[model samples]
Target: MLKTAFAPMALLAFVAALPAAARDVLVRDQAGFAAAAASLEPGDTIVLADGEWRDFAIKLVGEGTATSPITLTAQHPGKVILTGRSSLAVGGTHLVVSNLVFRNGFASGDEVIATRVGKRWSENLRLTGIMIDSFSNPDRRFEDHWVALYGRNIRVDHSHFEGKANAGAMLVVVREGKMPLDNRVTLDHNYFGHRPVLGSNGGETIRIGTSTESMSDSHSIVEDNVFERCDGEVEIVSVKSGGNVIRRNLFLASQGSVVLRHGNGNLVERNVFLGQGLPHTGGVRVINERQIVRDNYMEGLGGVDFTSAITVMNGVPNSPINRYLPVRGAVIERNTIIDAARITLGAGASDERSQAPQSTRFADNLIVNRDGKSPFRAEASLAGIAFVGNVASADPKVEGVVVERREVKLERAANGLLYPVGATAGAPRDLQPIAREATGVAWYPKPAGTRVAFGSGATVEVATGPALAAAVANARDGDVIQLRPAQYLLAEPLVVRRTLTLRGHSATLRFSAPTLFQLEDGASLQLRDLKLSGSAAPRQPGNAVIRASAKPMLVNYTVDIEDCAFAEMAGAPGFDVIATVPATLAETIRIVDTRIADVSGAVLAGHSEKGKEGFYNAERVVFDGLDMARVATIADLFRGGTDESTYGPQFTMTDSSIADSGAVLLSGVQETTITGNRFVRSGGIRVTHSVGSPHTEIAHNSFTATPAPVIEELHYTGPARALLADNRVSQ
Candidate 1:
């Protein structure tokens, strides 16, 4: 949850000592915000109002003392939403921004949020509880990033980020042309979800330094974060620069590995990778020299080639940023790998230009192959690589080495010694468990509700009948309405204009008309544990289950449907779930743990029939743990637009199953990520006119009796680059 209250009185006393003019200012509009920012000083606080602000650029450019930094915060945490082509730049020293949400926006600049405005860099800056969702504009032909860090001693923590669809990383720590300065940044306790492939290279969750600055030493730290389905082509966390530390992070169902792509002297330790039987779930890949990989646990990794559990790559003598450099003095020690396909040494050794790893040591490591498969494979000769006291067994009789099914328990020691036998081998005590049960937004706890804001409107229970309309009409913000088990037939479209939740207990809602639900501007709706059924007759040309308009200048509308069932109805030419009209602003749509069976049209559609310049583009749309079966066409599952004038959509589908479906098509969009999904006799994915030619990622999926060509590229004249790795297809 976001922290809305100020700090203790003791801290406020220090701020009170500042100049009288340097006081707290409450700003409600853009003009007031501009005036406040221009006159900000030390110990000043700018509190934004709890509403939506559109197309505002916040360039915080003032220096503050170490003891009294300037702060920009929301009046009510998570309530101040900024949308519609917004940008933020934080420069100068000792500055902070917290609890502000930026969504449904595109960047006219190079980045959506940046530390350096132009030539100035930030120092001692901290960003907390800020959320950046789906900040990309597909109409811009060039590349754009979400967050760019070009400062020293920066800390970004306790934040949430979803749907970075354009090119570049979610967060980038840049090194300015080998200036002998360590960035010393730290990113922790954040949640990064579903970053799609950026067609070409350089699509990472967190990247330090670029090819030109690859030799620079960043010395950054990335820890305690959850990266779920971050299949951004290659290098989930790319440590291009040297002396970076990546530890205690949870990588769940990601296709790429943490790669030391450039530079040397990096440390990757105590990271936990839970593949959960997904293909191409890699652990670590070592590229440059003098890197240490220790005390990590990797389980259920099924990737071959360079994406193996632990891969040591052959380096080019004078390699560029894109190519690998030789590995020297890499120590792989005290780690446990369970059910991984291969632990490769000297990957790409056949390329004579790439030299083999020198002085690399693999010691005190335990590899448990439960299926009696070989865990170690050497692509080239291990000439200078040292292999000392490594154990490979189907059943290792060591304490704390419990193996059940495909998972292994190596947290405790049985005989007071770690497996694989070395002097420095022991269990690590610093590793923390990451929450896997809560996938996306559930990772963040919801605020406790007040007593008066309970049940429908006033803790009232409405039985199954025409009373739902009355209950909805009487509902207030944050009201919960409970429905009993019965069928509700709505004669007209039910329009919701408040923040409310409709929960069902074995209840079914059937629409007699074409449209079922319509969300007005500034409305937020959540439907949980209900069954939504469409009309029995075929859907007309413009009918939809749910319809919402885009009002960018208004509030950021949200619709969350979870643990529900969408029963199969008659065939329809329109969408089955939701559709937005053209020229609408950005909105959020999330469908979790739902089942949709026997649907005729696209599951979700976003388009403008009139071809308006500013069409309705989704800020972020996520589909998790969905079981979709017998759909007519999966093509344009969640479309952005029909042509080039429309901006792309940011879409992510994880842990879902699609069986007997048609082709999935993405055109004129930014990104479409498909990870850890099962396809049974379904059509493949087609990409055309996407901003990044292959910004779509189809990774770690299982295909049984699917089409011959799993991924098709159409009309993309550039280098067709999509990351298709670790897919298990049984033709």
Candidate 2:
């Protein structure tokens, strides 16, 4: 095999019939090269001397079989440069062109192409170790597809392409004519860089598509390529093509990345992506079916939260209709995402037709968010999403964060079984009288009777997981509560409104009703080492097993909950769990070291009402090491209204894990910082209602399975004051 870094050894070996004679026919000038190339014979060699060859139009007029192909080589490798008034067209098959430079070629007004017309249809074409440059300047108006290819058995390797100053698309492959051939193209080890000086009208680095309709392709590969500062994008568009691969490519300062339309059985893996101006349409757009995207890096430039990191749609918008359509079915696995404050999966808008169903499977990934929650959405009917063995955490508060107590109870149980006695199981009955205090009052722990019992002297309740409700029902003010480890079933969310503490361990707390826990009416409470969950059955209603509903003017009321786990057990409802509350005025809350799993919508912090709805100003909230797995509504928080008037930013989550399902929802507040967390197998993140210079800092996090916009600053309303840095992001 006559192997060259640019030429495929397979193609070289196939042309075995070519004579091995080193006949170097030298052409010192353009005219000699033109005449010689026009009459070139098979097994012949055309060598150009080490000098400038200008105004030459070399077209293949002879045929070359796989066994006897012609060779065009530079006499001194890259010393020979060709400048032509028109493209150099090669219509013959099994050709080898290597180690030469093609620059300043005059392109037709219809197409700014420097190579042969892909429509000429040649198979087994090898373009290796060549440098093609277009220095046409920025003012030139070129056509869409540069370097258009339309044949099978194509090999483009070890090449360098630069569009010095032009507004054009690069490396386009499409079906040109009726006798279109299935392309088996190999694009590898290439360098694509656009002129950064041009600025405004730069071009995408690579594009693969069809001309009239979807073109069927058997095998195509794009690997080990480096693209930098190219206004162009790297994309795949197919109406009927199947089986392609894009792997191990480095992209920086590109417009966007995508896999759209009818291409099936495609694989995108091991690619590194960076930069911005992400089309404003999102990242990794997929409208095709049966595609596998894995082990890639997708990072953004500065702080621009456009959309999810990976967007898979069943169809495209109605307008600008193309030949290809969208469908369902995809596999997204093991890709690292960093610093994207928005959701990772995009299924179009809520009202679009051909919307993507939640059918994509996700597994074995690591996701992180810096200053905001992850934006990853999982719709209904999407099944078999395995999210196992992942960690989600964030940084600690340096400016001294406020801790609050929302729900507390005092009761007793035995041997992992509920006493089935009292109604408010572990809630201290004696404390009920003092539970309701005036608004804007802070309640600190007292060293009195029952309050100073177990677990940091927080409170000891005599209730197991099963008897938790009975214990709460019998709880009184200033009562100590001790609980055992096991399933303690409850009919309603335990509401704590007194200065009390509830402690439990080695026990499970089950809820038979909605809103597993609620803290309202000026209550200050603390909870530790407890497991709260919804009914352990399926098809439940819309309600969070643990909810905190407080009034707008309520102040100094805190809920400090730590080291607890919440889950929607087997066959539980499809959605809504963890936390839910209607918007109230201002309050303080904190949740630490908690785990939520297998439910729809993990947390809905505040729900708003109509007309002058209560204000919600949460003072200090900490979501430390909160891991959410397979739970719906992992990130689905909504602002009060659509219009700008009714909004505020008052929540901050530090150190949390949202690994799958739903999207991150941010509502009204002054400032919110989401630092050091993981968001995997989920949708995007949404933030609204910013007050003052309501800043959101997303620093040092991982998003391991989906594409999303990293939210740095919101437009008009306020600045996100987003700071994104030093992170690992993969596509």
Candidate 3:
């Protein structure tokens, strides 16, 4: 959200007082657009109409004042879709382009949009409220980029980018020559989604400066953006130049991490990496000298080798642009890493030719390992690195390196500097709020909430396993099956088909195997005051404790779980406590007053099934007063898929607390309200790929001991409508 304070009436009066040559103009097609571009003046607006303009190219060469920029915008945001080999070459100074959509298009040249048209570089350019969706070539080879900027003081904000396929990066900042100053670019409040892995390298989502210009200073800022499934072989946002800042961004299920591949004196801070147990998913990969990586939270990272949570690679001194340089004076501090398999200190240690990173500092870092294995894996000796005040599950004996052996415990506090152990860590900042009139569109409708009334019916008391099984099988609607204070071992899943209540009075259900108590369509289950544990050890992939699948027929299903606990349940690495379902059916799941500990999977995971077209939709869901700790990953705490028709999930969570968890990926979802929740040392909440404007409300949430920007909304094209407000976030 980007807000600009401008009085329309005052602006009208000021414009009316100006000469007619300074007025705005409407351009409906390529001819009019060219005419406007040829005679573009300061304080002028060139309006592109709403239609499919195919194979059009625009070379905007204009000179606007610092106070007045030449504007090129659509008649309506997301309405003027540009298709088929369109290109925009911006040159000159003080230009503004907004509210244009470029989709179903292929590049006619190396880039669809370029700031440097020929040898001239644009200056003080701003692109806002723009959307580029599924803009790719026919071969899916990234031969061109969506945006190739070669300019100074450039700002790209509040834009939506989706489905970038092929061989090149989605966005690139090129440096043609050494300038007097760095290219000061700001990329904020943008959404980058679904860029698949290019078989080889060179497919970064955002590449700032190239290897040839790696040493040149590019003081760019990339913030408040969402990177979802942008797994373009490693290095999602490759920093090749020096003195850039990447902060307060959400990287959700993206295969790679932010890499300072060739730069020095760069800052990577307050970013959230929600890997969700995906292969090759990682955190920040460090190289070069005087770089700072701090206050980032990484969870469910499964990558090994250089793709670990934080990999400090050995550098070759005075190396070429493509080769790593000796990493000196690097500081890695105040980061929380949970359920990551590897946190390598010396990534290139095995290669003797690669020089060891020297004078690096690692401090105030917390690594919580649920598995029995050690979190720190060093390939080289730690003699040259400075390791201090780092907390892990156990002593990470790195030969000569000594780390403080203390249990990392994270709790919610009013004012905490760093995220406690087991809390979401990352950039906890929100985008600047944009005024509604700035976007020229209305927000999407907010979903209504549905509250179900539960009945207290007859009670069936059970003392033994057989009695409990029989009672569950014979239970009627609104009947309560109460279990006595005992441990019951079940060999199979208890399939509940009718409406009933399963209450526990100091009772525990230990499953012989990984099984789920499933609830079918038209069935409702209420579980209260029970403990569920699995006898199996935590292994590869685990199973869910509760499962619900929607049938093809549209029906309503409900599951209300309260005051319960889940422990020692070994789920598949990426599985969840609640399994995936379909979108055709209306379902309501409410988990309140519960404590989930030592769980190896997510609390609730939703996804569109493979070969399935629709999403796993829920009419309304709520999570209240939940204490979720020591969990492996909350992958998409409300997960959705890539299918466009799959509607977003409407859900809310209030008065809940989560620590040591993965991200709550609200991509492709709508109408989410997360209020009064306490997130300590956990992954951030990211909303992206949304269907409507102002689709979610996140208010009054206390984010203590966390990074900046607790909540982020990315790549939404609709009008801004008061979504995030009054959240207490500590940096």
Candidate 4:
């Protein structure tokens, strides 16, 4: 009886010694927050007051139990705004960060939210109800990430990350050391919105592992997310690690694919691609081994090749870890593909990537092609591939599988999707896609961007150099700065940031500046009826009349030079009439009714960006109705260097006249058509006709008294599939 009494007394003493119940501490500044956080116990809450918190480096490091987690939240959800070099560093176990907004700002360092600080890391942490909107660097070339996840058992849910107009993936799961990653992180119910075309390779939405961790297993899960118009690069969710599962996500009108890029043993299942016939919207691409793609529903995707509705890629023979690995045991089964552009097999075969997919099974899918387009286009051989139990609108007698095709009629499902009527479960009859409204926070508004029509804003007229410079600096978002018909000798270069038209009525703007006008990211410059010339003493600078950018940058709006004339550009050897620096990309460069004469350099030049994997600066280049003479090289527009991505470097130079110029180098581009153009004593067209760019045509062009070799074919591999016909050449 005495022993029982002593035990009860000891238990009572221990319970009395425990700290008081958890409390909520309100902090107004970073120092107060840090002080409150240091003394926090389990279940303690630190609430930040509602205000504009600028340049706050928050370090919420603590240790808490699973049942009573430490929380850092706002007084009101999304009322505590952080801007200008604000970052959140989270460490320790069971820590929760919720209900804050990081907007109109960029990270002071590389990451906005990093789970690991030095050697300390967070495990079993939850980051929920956060908004990172327009949190991008001023320089789009500089790379940064919103959330860089490390450690294990992390959950990022119900968040809104929008308007990432810079380099780097929005979120990345990284692992330290050389060991394989086993993070088990879950990314769910998030909205990745408004990621414009980054025009580079570092524009993925969520990248699980990287080329360094390609051979490792992450075991991560990305599900129930909505990717809204995230047209960054060719790969949206690049799965570079093994054993990760991506399921039930809605890729809504995005321009890239969910690529199994590097590692193997990944599963992509039940995702719905609601493309709605959007151009360049893609589904899934299969690479590596043991990847399973099953029970997915994709429709109205307009991308082809690597960005196809379903692309099974050809791999490199004996590839390294960073390069393309051969696709083995890729099981693609029971998917519904309707009204999509192309379901390609053996896609992206080149000089190095020549190994066909071995032991792959593509079975039990339903393909409905109503556009009368051939639903298939193959570059690699169909050996060792199996296509079985699939119902297609076209003929089912394709190479690979010997299984007979199924005869089924198409019927509209209740969810507005077309399904195989009277089909079983294996025919994808029960795949229920999620609604977009259920994912993100209802209060946080979705981003809306409208292409400001040219000359739609206030019309400001400027005559002098200072007036023109001031007008450009103070113009509205979509203003038209009409340069009065006079010679505006500008002393400094002008950088444009908004969508504007610089209309000059027979005006001449002569300058010695390296770049007369610089177009930054998200800026559009439309030069209408301007006579541009440069006659100052040459300073050996690679000057451009209207340079796009000198450094690497992200996507710019447009550069339309209509009815413009370039008299001369007297500068260094690398001078160009209108130039784009390396890795600086523009959406379109349409020079219509343009005339170039007495130019010492190329009309268009940006070919310095060259290396391994084919990434040029521009997406499309059009030189229509151009009259050119005395120019060095009439137009040397290098689009795709050696890219295997499906997005094209479309080039169309139709009805142009060139004389006494350099060679027109256009071999590395795709979607090319050079017809009805006249060349006189100048360099002929030099192009490579490979299997990768088979849809090329150089036809119906007259060459009078030209050189002996009018068309130089620099074939890389295989015979030329390009149509070089109906040319009249007189030597």
lDDT of 2 by residue, 336-356 (tens): 544443433344323333344
Evaluate candidate 4 by giving its C-alpha RMSD to the native, one decimal. 4.0
lDDT, candidate 1, 500-594, per-residue tens: 78889869998767777777754678888999887553456656677775332233467788999986554566545777654343346799999
Candidate 3's TM-score = 0.57
Per-model TM values vs. the true structure: 0.58, 0.47, 0.57, 0.87
Minimum summed lDDT over a 10-residue window in model 3 is located at 440-449
Q: What is the lDDT of residue 233 in candidate 2?
A: 21
Off by over 4 Å in 1: 1-21, 139-142, 178-180, 197-199, 320-322, 394-430, 436-731
For model 1, what is the C-alpha lDDT against the true structure?
0.71
Instruction: Identify the superior model by TM-score, candidate 1 or candidate 3.
Output: 1
lDDT of each: 0.71, 0.52, 0.71, 0.81
Which should have the higher lDDT, number 3 or number 4?
Answer: 4
Per-residue alpha-carbon lDDT of candidate 3 for residues 401-517, written as tens digits (9 for 90 to 100): 556665556443332222454533222323222222222122211112222235456789999877887887787767888898799877767777677788888699876544557
What TM-score quantifies how close candidate 4 is to the native fold? 0.87
> For candidate 2, which ten residues in a row score worst on lDDT?
432-441
Which of the two, 2 or 3, has more TM-score?
3
Residue 525 lDDT, candidate 1, scale 0-100? 80
Stretches off by above 4 angstroms in model 2 are 1-22, 65-68, 84-86, 104-119, 137-140, 195-202, 233-240, 275-283, 299-308, 314-324, 350-354, 375-731
Give me the displacement of residue 348 in model 2, in angstroms. 3.0
